[model samples]
Target: MSERQQAEAGRVRLASALSASGALTSEWVEAYQAVPRDWFVPDLIWPGRADGVRQEESAHRLADPARWWEAVYSDIPLTTQWDDGEHTGNGRGTTPTSSNSMPTMVFSMLAALNPQDGHRVLEIGTGTGWNAALLSHQVGDGNVVTVEVDQESAAAAKYRLAQAKCAPRIVVGDGAKGCPDGAPFDRVIATCSVRRVPYEWVAQARPGAVIVVPWAPEYGGEAVVRLTVGEDGTASGRFVGSSAFMRLRRQRAERPNSLAYLSGPWPADGVRSTTTLSPEDVGGWLAMFAVGARVPDAFPLVERYADGSYTLWLHDTAVTSWSTVDWEPGRTSYEVVQSGPRSLWDEVAAAHYWWRDQGHPGFERFGLTVTPEGETVWLDSPAT
Candidate 1:
């Protein structure tokens, strides 16, 4: 089939799938049809999996139009820029800095935002301008302001938006600062994920305005949160659904490698022990969320060996402590080693047990409340 034929067919198939899955709702169908994903996607792209973690081989529109079209229309993210545009060529870069987000995530966030016909919307991380275009379609172009931290990405997104007849005010600056000139917006949304919801977003929004964003803790696991700006200068809400997106440039954390935390050679001055709790138990996305919520300033990394066995390394952001858990197949217990000031594994295990005791509550059951002081993740209600 021709490229045009493939594009149309793929679009139909994807729309059907998204609609059936309830990600693409009726309200956004017209906007989705109007602004095709291909218009924002570049010629060379790396398609991410449905889980939003892994990326497949590069698909070029010229060399392999079929694969490119398939990737464009599929309900998956397309990595457009890598390493803040320093890495070049088709090969994957050290990090995927920007992407046209997964269609399901895009629509789901839009549904959560629930913008009105003329509502003013502020978008952070205008990766490929696809989201900005979609928002411009839902609420008029003049009412939308999008901020992108990367100047190159902002320029490219501006060009695509113009081609698609979308002219939302594009600002190139720190997205965490938000667009101050466009203050007191009725609604705010961020395509990129943030470790902490910048208080600037809350301050820039009018009282009662809704702010939808992908919020992730330092450790792992992420979800989209729908927060309503309160009259008391606070924002709080629940996790609408699970999400995995690139971190906002300003909020990106500097994670030191495992070697940096060690004082001497392997297990030097370290305490060793064994535990019945499998290392695998605390590695799930939701499990990580629970542990990350309770165990602050800690993150996990995996080191795999030539054999199937691997070690999970937990490090504190403060660079003060580290722990290691060895995982092997069919093991009733696992070996753990700890060093420094904190008992990382013990804290993780305790957090995991707490989550299990609560019946493994899903993302919806957890909520976040951001105040001038800081943000708090609560269960069922903020008071708890």
Candidate 2:
């Protein structure tokens, strides 16, 4: 076995995955085993952890045994890039491009997709094409169609897919617009994170089929939602679970401070406005789901060395309008405003109220329906 193959993370991971997906369809499980994830990931990539990538430094994907093995095997997602555009993924900047999603989360999402043989599938945000290969194994290579917006990343992923012998028709287009030429798919899955369900997905699905995507909730976080399309193109289902995936390729995710409107005349009052958990958590969740619109897989706050505290700041894209909500205790206060166009907190607070009215319990109660025209999210009521 090649060094990368010998360091097989899937050997153990696949075992755990099989057990976790107890009721998984037999066909799905076999496909999972057939497609090795390492083949899809580059020999060198970043691990999603406490600065797993050397600061402003590059590391070989197979050079370090423990780091490589752990990063490939672990559930934490690795950072692929920063600054949205074609910035070299040399482990610097802000925009995250691609990642080998935590192994279990990948299983969780695929299990949720539940693809079957002959089921035509449409996949969005091909990323590293790992999920596409897995889907191809279950649905047949010819039945899978995957889309990616980044030309460079898409080209690299195309090469990787060839290496793995899994080539689903990869389209270089905006995933927001589902691959139309290959419409009427049996199942559709998105690897990157999403805020709103794309209308194109609704238009592309075969009736009674499933379209699985992640959506941010008003409750300050994101829930991976699975909606089964109706004969009429409407769909609905509950939040399958939580995951943190990147947004669709090149989609500029913005954060809206919806909570401040509830704070009223005083910022202190807003602090106690019912949804006040730690601002770090709330803001993180919002950025993941709403404004920042990142993946809901989740992140941790840890210090690696002396003065190595992680500071997650919520600010305007231009950095002119900025706010502070540090993870530390009582060290920072939020600036909230409700009545203006830029009032980000107010918008979030409104979303919270909307969700609470539907039943403040959790994401389990929420659902969505997408159509060729648009999409709708409702409680109890299925989309169609």
Candidate 3:
């Protein structure tokens, strides 16, 4: 088929799928149809797997038009920039820095934002400007402002937005600080994820304004939170759904390697034990979120062996504690070794059990309340 024919066919198929999935709601359907994702996507791209954790080989529009169009029209995200635009060549970089987010995530977050006509909206990440374009279409160009940390990305997005005739104010700066000049916004949305919702965003928004952001704890797992700014200058709301966006640049965690926490070789001054709880139990996304919410300031890393067994290493941000749990096939219990002040495994197990006792609630059951003092993740209600 011709390129135009391919584009139309793919667009129709994707729109149908998204509509069936209930992500592409009627309100945003016009914007979705008008703002083609290809206009913002670059020539060379790395398509992410449907699982959202891995990337496939690069697809270039010039070299492989069919694959490029397929990826653009697919629901999955496409990684456009890697390692803050430092890494070169066709191979994947150490990290995916910028991406055209998956269509489901984009539209779902937009639906959660639910901006009205003429409502001033502030967008945190302008990865490829597709989201900014869509927002512009929904709520006029003059009322939208998008902040991007990467200058190169900001320039590219600006060009794309201009070409699409959707001109939202694009600010090249720290997205965490937000655009204070455009303060008193009616709505705020962040394409990037944050460990803490920057108070600047809350401060800039008017009372009763809504802030939709992908929030993740230090340990792992993440979800998009739909918070309403209260008269008291706080934002509180439940997690709308699961999400896996890139961390906001400024809020990205400084995770030390396991070697940094070791005082000696091998076990490294560790005490060993065993637990009835399997390592696999605490490794799922939701499980990690539950554990991370209660545990605080700790993260996990996995070291897999050729035999398919793996060691789950837990480390605190302070580097004062470390723990390891071994998992192999058909193991009822796992070996555990912990060192330093905090008993990491015990904390994780306790948190996991607490979640289980609470009926293993999904993201919707959990809520976050961000106050001037701090943020709290609560189950069922904030009082808890």
Candidate 4:
């Protein structure tokens, strides 16, 4: 089939899938159809999954138009830039810095924004300009302010927007700071995930404005949080659904090498222990989120071996403590080593226990309350 015909067919399939899944609502249907994802996607891209974490190798349209076209319309994300556009060659980069997000996530977030015909929207991370184009179509170009930190990406998106004849105000600046010139915005949405909901965003938005963003804890689980700003300068809301997007550039975590934790040879200054809770028990995304919420300030890294065994390293952000759990396939108990004042493994286990006892609440049960003091997460209600 021709590229145009393929794109049209893909759109139909995508729209059907999204509609059946309830992500592509009637309110945003016109905008979704109007903004063809192909118009905003670049030729060279890395096709990734819906989770937004892993990517297959590069797929270039010029070299293989069929593969590139297939990737663009599929339900998965398309990584457009890597390592802030610093990496070389056609292969994958060390990190996925920017992307044309998955179609489902894009429309889901737009639906969460609950856009009105004339509502002024402040959008963070204008990676592909497709989202901005959709917003421009929904609420008028003048009412959409899209911010991107990377100059080259912002420029490219601007060119694409120009080609599409949907020119939203694209600002090349820190998205966390938001576009204050477009103050009192009716809605705020972020394409990138954030560890902390930036207070500056709250300050700029009008009361009762909805801010939809992908929020994650330091330990590594993410979800889309819908917060409604209050008159008292507080924004609180429940996590609408699970989501995974690249971290907001400035909010990205500082993950040091595992060697940094070890001062000397193997198990140096470490206390050895064993646990009935297997490493396999605490590996999935939900388990990570549950444990991360209780045990903040630490992150996990895994090192795999050829023998199907792996070591899960737990490190504190302070660089003061570290622990390791060795998991072999079918092992009932795992070998653990700890060093420093805080027993990272014990803390994790306790957090896991706490979560399990709480009935393993899903993302929706978790709510965030962001006030002048700080952010606090609660189960069901803030009082809890």
Candidate 5:
């Protein structure tokens, strides 16, 4: 089939899938169909898996048009820019800096925003301008204001928006600032994940405005949070669903090397322990979320071997504590070596038990309350 046919077919299939999944609602189905994700996506892309953070190599339109088209139509995210546009070539970069988010997630967040006919919207990230265009269509072009941290990405998205026959104000600035000139917007949306919901976003939004953003903790895991702005510079809401998006540049966490945590060789100045908790138990997205919620200032890194086995390295953001849990297939117990002032493995195991005790609550059960002071995550309700 022709490219046009493929694009149309993709849109139809995506719309159907989203509708079936209850993400692509009737209110925004036309906008999803109208704004072809491919129009905004770059020619060079790294298609991402739904459950995995790694990309499966790069697919260039010139070299592999069929694969490119297939990736664009699929309901998965496509990594467009890597390493803040530093490292180049066909290979995948160290980190995925920006991406055209998954269609389901894109529409789901939009659905959460639930903008009115003439409501003004502030978009934190304009990766490809597809989101801004969709917002422009739902509201008016003049009613949408998008901020992009990277100038190159902002300019490229601007061009794509113009090509799509829409002209939303695209600002080249930090997304956390939230376009003060467009203050008191009816709704605010962030395409990137944030460690903390910026106070500027809440301040810029009108009272009762809905703010949809992907929020991740320092430990690990991420989810889309839908917050309702309060009149008093605060926003509190429940997590609508799980998500994995590129971090907002300003809020990106510093990931020091795991070796930095060690003062000497393996097991040096360390304590050894064996636990029935298999390394496989603490893996997966939701499990990470549960552990991250309780364990602060630490994150996990996996070192894979030639075989399926690997070591899970837990490092504290302060660079003071470190722990390693070795996992082998069909193992009843795991070997753990922990060092430094903090017992990182103990904290993680405690978190896992806590989550299990809470009936293994999902993302929907968790909520966040963001104020000028800081953000607090709670299970079930903010009161908890």
Candidate 6:
């Protein structure tokens, strides 16, 4: 078989494995079968995981179909950009702007979306047109409108989509505004993660339409949220799974924090769970909330590293206040009491307690409601 054909066979096998394991849905298999990922990916693009510790690596896309398909199907994230927009190639570190999300994650997202044939869809973040191509395959290509902010990226994606013969209307512009011309989409799916659900998405989607996107709290942890737009224009749904996606184009911002505030010790007695809980869960999200709310719009979750070190770095946004506790095996506990006007941990404790009393579950049941300017959450049982 030709190298490209050989790679397709391998990818198909991998997809089959993922499906047999139930990591992917059957429709997802059909989509994968219909769309060849290599078709949209540029012959040469940046690779995931830079070569060295310098935080930067050169773009490397080779001619070997086996290698190319392997890279495409790998579960690890590929870095699309770096240095926060200043650098694209080797030399120094840069932040990732886009990527071909892992196949399993993509399948999970599509499964969550479950867009029916002929359903109108608006996809935000047309990275390489790979995803938009798949969506177009399901819904008529004419029924899809995808928006990307990077002009060069947008142009490249359009050509790739055309080459793939998927003629989704690709727009080069800020996606936050939503495509007004394609208003009332049956499904609105954002490939990127966002700090808040945009009001425009809900407004542009037909009432009761599904909106699927990555929803994270003030902290960096992300949950794939699926909400049904309400007749009042609000949307609500809870997180279904975990995923890491590039941040939305317009949502990029830098907040600073004092590094001194970060180091701490995890509580010894363990967390008080009003709900069934894990130690890391308490330490991770609740701790982040405690720190940020006290620091208010200041301490944002920046870089989280292994070695038991997490950075809640922010600017004089006063987010410089960092609080980090050591990870204790089988023991994740925190006192989280603050001396300032705001008790960050106290609030987290309250949330945990509230959740605990309500049977200490449903972190998954957290639903989303969207308005034009703002978004809110509601508990499924009204208990937590």
TM-scores for candidates 1 onward, in order: 0.98, 0.73, 0.98, 0.97, 0.95, 0.78
Q: How many backbone clashes does candidate 1 have?
A: 0
- Residue lDDT tens for model 1, 59-87: 89999988889899998888998899999
Estimate candidate 3's alpha-carbon lDDT, on a 0 to 1 scale.
0.93
What does candidate 2's lDDT look like per residue over 205-273, in tens digits?
888888888776322356789988888767777777766677675454454443322334434232322
Which candidate, 4 or 6, has the higher TM-score? 4
Q: Write the per-residue lDDT of candidate 4 for residues 1-384, one digit (tens) a residue.
A: 987899999889888989999989999889888888999999999998766656658999999999998888889989888899998579988888999999999999999899898899999999989999999999999999999999999999999999999989999999999988789899999999998999989999899999999998888888999999999999999999889899999998879998898889998899999999987778878888888888889999999999989999999999989999999988888899999888999999998999889998999999998887779888899898
User: Which ranking of candidates, highest lDDT first?
Assistant: 3, 1, 4, 5, 6, 2
In terms of lDDT, which candidate is stronger, 1 or 2? 1
Candidate number achieving the greatest lDDT relative to the actual structure: 3
Steric clashes per prediction: 0, 36, 0, 0, 0, 30
**Deviation of model 6 at 243, angstroms:** 1.5
How does candidate 4 fare on TM-score? 0.97
Superposed by TM-score, candidate 4 places the C-alpha of residue 102 at a distance from the truth, in angstroms, of 0.4
Query: lDDT of each model, Cα atoms only?
Result: 0.93, 0.62, 0.93, 0.91, 0.89, 0.65
In model 6, state the lDDT of residue 191: 91
lDDT value, residue 357 of candidate 2: 54
| Model 4: how far residue 216 lies from native, Å | 0.8
TM-score winner, 1 or 4: 1
- By lDDT, the better pick of 2 and 5 is 5
Answer with 4 or 5, whichever has the higher TM-score. 4
Output the TM-score of candidate 2.
0.73
lDDT: worst 10-residue window of model 3: 48-57
Better of 3 and 4 by lDDT: 3
Candidate 5 Cα misplacement greater than 4 A, ranges: 52-54
